[model samples]
Target: MSNLSKLEFVALDISGKNFLPWTLDAQIHLTAKNLGETIIDDNETSLQDKAKAMIFLRHHLHEDLKREYLTIKDPLELWNNIQDRFDHQKLVLLLKARSEWIHLRLQDYKSVSEYNSALFRISSELKLCGDNITDEDMLEKTFSTFHPSNLILAQQYRERKFTKYSELISCLLVAEENNKLLLQNHQARPVGTNPLPETNAISTRSKHGRGRSGGPHRGRGRGRGRSNTWHRESHNTKIDGGRGSSRQNTGRPHKGRVSGDKDNICYRCGMSNHWSRTCRTPKHLVEAYQRTMKEKGKQTETNLIEGAPNSSSPAFWSDTHLEACDFIENVRDV
Candidate 1:
């Protein structure tokens, strides 16, 4: 066997039972040969058959492995024809392993080869054709390019959308710091220098009256002069107005006689001090008045209680006296 065949045999041996079956391999090769003959002879095969053959080869062994077996010089050209052959999960797992291995080597050696290898592995495994780029850029682009449903799935895994670029950068910086701490005994340089003093700083005055613009005589002397003038004018005006009004009202002569003079008496009550309206009397005055009136009417056969000489008798009471008694009774009830 050739060196390449020997290598394939060794790879199959290492893979053990996980490797493709001999019978499946024969069938795939025969199918490929027939398909090739039909293409060369210009004989059309149904798209369905082509799809079925592709599925059969992919299930048995991936397109890349099949191309390796065919010893294709330019395998990338066959990538499209073989992409539908493999299990997507298996491809993703292989790509993930390759990506992680390349990333691990990146810390030791920063090389374009390592980066390209990682990219090619990831793109091939993901069946990603267009827009393959740097892993960091690719991850961001892929996250951005997801369909709504796929984005929701990614959110479930990542716990949030790809917003907060600053926060993400901060987290990355903190992670880098933690890694450095682990490797360097937790020591780090301080971030920045202390700030310089401002050039236009002002000195505060220590004494209360030291900084006055007019040297202490300025505000107080001017303020007192204005205040005294205003106060004198206001006080004089008030005093003059009060005296004038009092003199005008009091200069008029007294009218008739004072209301409570000794010679006068209440017309309704024969009281000496108060008028009839203000005289105090018992509450039963109305009933007593009615009874007296009724008695007078029987005796005189007329409503002559006011003009009768009997009304002036010593036992006779006045209407004002009755009213005073009623007022006293109301006060008692309250």
Candidate 2:
């Protein structure tokens, strides 16, 4: 009595697979309504074409389809499950075909998820063989090499139900430790089997003969004794007496010395002993020179002003000359 199309019923039936009941009558009704003929009498209909037709029907009845019948939102998640199933089926087929060894070479992964995914894929693929090896055993064999993180992850995975990709890093840590041990064990031994003449482990005298070379002599207590002798001599009366005499005679005229009187006034300008060049009295010649400079500066400034279009007025020249005169007078006073 339901007005639902026949293709919709067929899609629902196909999508449900063997879990759901398939009614030939309902399928024929759907084929008849949509294709204008019954497909139940088909002769070797391809599953691909059937799947495509089902997809078309599913799209047409998308709103009617339940969430359970829909594919996973993430293609990768869907692919992971699909790949697991495919790998299992493929491995079984390969074994049936009598392929001796099932080898799977995995690509390097940076992320933990990538590693987990790859491991999951490999483990799932290997599971198809139904060999004596268990999932835990396969994981252990795959991660036999020592990597720090991988080792920890492997232990964790064994204790826990899930295997993580972090276990692969164990090999790297193990290799590092091995290299460190190798370096530590590498010793530079003397070439000759017989040990070299055993010299005194604690020699009182140095290898260099005492006083033979210009370098300091090396004998027990010699250096310390010499240092004490030098120290004593340095502070003794004999050393102090000579130093005291040099200091006492430094700025004082010794016996038979005559002292001259200091000058009272400058020589060059007949001023204070500070000297004529440095006298406080201002030189008229400098003032004359400055005056000449000011006059020249004024003339140059006047010429510059006269040349400027903005200073064409007579008042500008009168004001400029007055400013120049004031500057000259100020200098003269200084």
Candidate 3:
């Protein structure tokens, strides 16, 4: 009784719906147990082997079948009677398989795996019914069932002349994955956004007219070491009175003796008596100026004007002088 519970497959049902596969499982299990010959006519198997085969067969039978064949003690006779009773299943399965095969189309399934699985299942039934499906047949079936939009793609695959179905499926799966990745990237960062920079990933533009290395001409400095000295010397003479030094202000107007003087005007807003950093103008106006400076190729450091919040700057330029001469005339109105 303990061994009987170890039946390797489901018991045959009274309806015989699973008769074909149950027969196959029974044969293989019997062969593995060295009792295969007991089911053949006039076998010379020992009595012990015959008992083992009969017990195995009976254990796998439906309750109704067991009662009907209660008197049949011979394994060969029981096997033959069961085969004769359900043999018509082959004909029924073959007809259904043929219909499914006739209607099978790759385009009808959403993915290659699904279509391949269905094809293999149908082909398995056909082969069991003595109808073999070859590799060429599978490849042709797939090629003919591509969606109408993929006609050209199908033609290209056919041109590759793959002898095996697996090779074509591999290429198609790879292409599908790549296309998905491309779409994901496009959707992540849609069009008209800031384009990726091609060259010069480093932006030397400083937030406070200073470079990462803390040189005075940092933003305008170009070409390694000497540009720092040239920038400090050239720009300081105009803005810093040749002090060549950095000054930290408390956002206040710098004390000055003269008003209405040309040199005392703020370079940022074209106003008098205040440095660009300490000007009290609205932030939007300063941002507009920053944009204009960029449009005019002035390319100020990320700080743009002197008094904005400090943030990361953008790519620097080699030229030292600010190209604000023409635009400075219009700054007074702003």
Best model per TM-score: 3
Give the Å shift of residue 316 in candidate 3: 75
The number of the candidate with the highest lDDT is 3
For every model shown, what is its TM-score relative to the native structure?
A: 0.18, 0.19, 0.57
Each model's Cα RMSD = 35.2, 30.0, 23.4
1-28 per-residue lDDT for model 2 (tens digits)? 2443334443332233311122333344
**Ten contiguous residues minimizing lDDT sum, candidate 1:** 227-236
Segments of candidate 1 deviating more than 4 angstroms = 1-28, 35-95, 98-108, 128-334
> Where does candidate 2 stray beyond 4 Å?
1-108, 128-133, 148-334
Candidate 2 structure, TM-score to reference: 0.19
Candidate 3 residue pairs in backbone clash: none
Listed per model in order, the count of residue pairs whose N, CA or C atoms clash below 3 Å is 9, 11, 0
Alpha-carbon runs more than 4 Å astray in model 3: 1-3, 194-334
Candidate 1 global TM-score: 0.18
lDDT of each model, Cα atoms only?
0.42, 0.42, 0.78
